[model samples]
Target: MMKRIALLWNVVKGDARVLWHALRQPERPVWLVPATALVALYALDPFNIAMPLAGVVDDGIIVPLLLHVMVRCLPAHMRRA
Candidate 1:
């Protein structure tokens, strides 16, 4: 697991340019789709959905938004550097 995390980090650093370019595409939607899906799932669950709600908010919403902002705010050459 540690190795996987390290590998992911390296890949992200090396491919920052590509990743930023992909993210900058105007057609790409932000976290809205997943947020909507999570809301729907919560609504559909007859039992209490508090656990899933928390999970989605933390993992899905917060993490992605943070990553998106971080990527977008990075300097252009730094992305490739």
Candidate 2:
């Protein structure tokens, strides 16, 4: 169980690093910016802000999906194995 948590943490950290790099690259794919913005908006949506329990549930499911989509939008050169 601890190993699984550690592994998941590492994966999340790696994804975050890759996304940060994509944001910094001048030649980043055009889709990246909008995708990121959409994720941010959804994460902070009024509905989420208004209902704490539902917000937690909604974010638990949706945030990772949005992050995956953003990562998938990365250019081939930026993608890690």
Candidate 3:
């Protein structure tokens, strides 16, 4: 469990760094901001799609998957090791 937590923390930190860099750049990809906003909105569950019991499961799986995809969609230059 600790290992998983540490890994998650590392990934979050790395993604945050990449996003900060992307935000500071003049030529950031057009999709970056909208995609990030979508992920944030989905995470907030404002639409209440997770009303059903199964919906919670969907949120658990989908949110992180969306985040992973969003980070992956960043330009190679924006991504770091």
Each model's lDDT: 0.52, 0.78, 0.73
TM-score of each: 0.32, 0.77, 0.68
Which scores greater on TM-score, model 2 or model 3? 2
Q: Report the C-alpha lDDT of model 3 over 1-81, residue by residue, as the tens digit.
A: 789868866876677677768867888999888887877777777455537566666665676667667779888877763
Query: Candidate 1: where are CA atoms >4 Å away?
Result: 1-53
Tens-place lDDT per residue, model 1, 1-81, is: 789768756655554445546455564457534544554465455443557766644554444454445555555654453
RMSD of each: 9.7, 2.5, 3.1
lDDT of 2 by residue, 1-81 (tens): 789758756766677778888888888888888888888898889997779899977886678667766777776788763
Q: Between 1 and 3, whose lDDT is larger?
A: 3
By descending lDDT, how would the candidates be arranged?
2, 3, 1
Lowest summed lDDT over 10 consecutive residues: which window, candidate 1? 59-68
Error of 3 at 9 (Å): 1.9
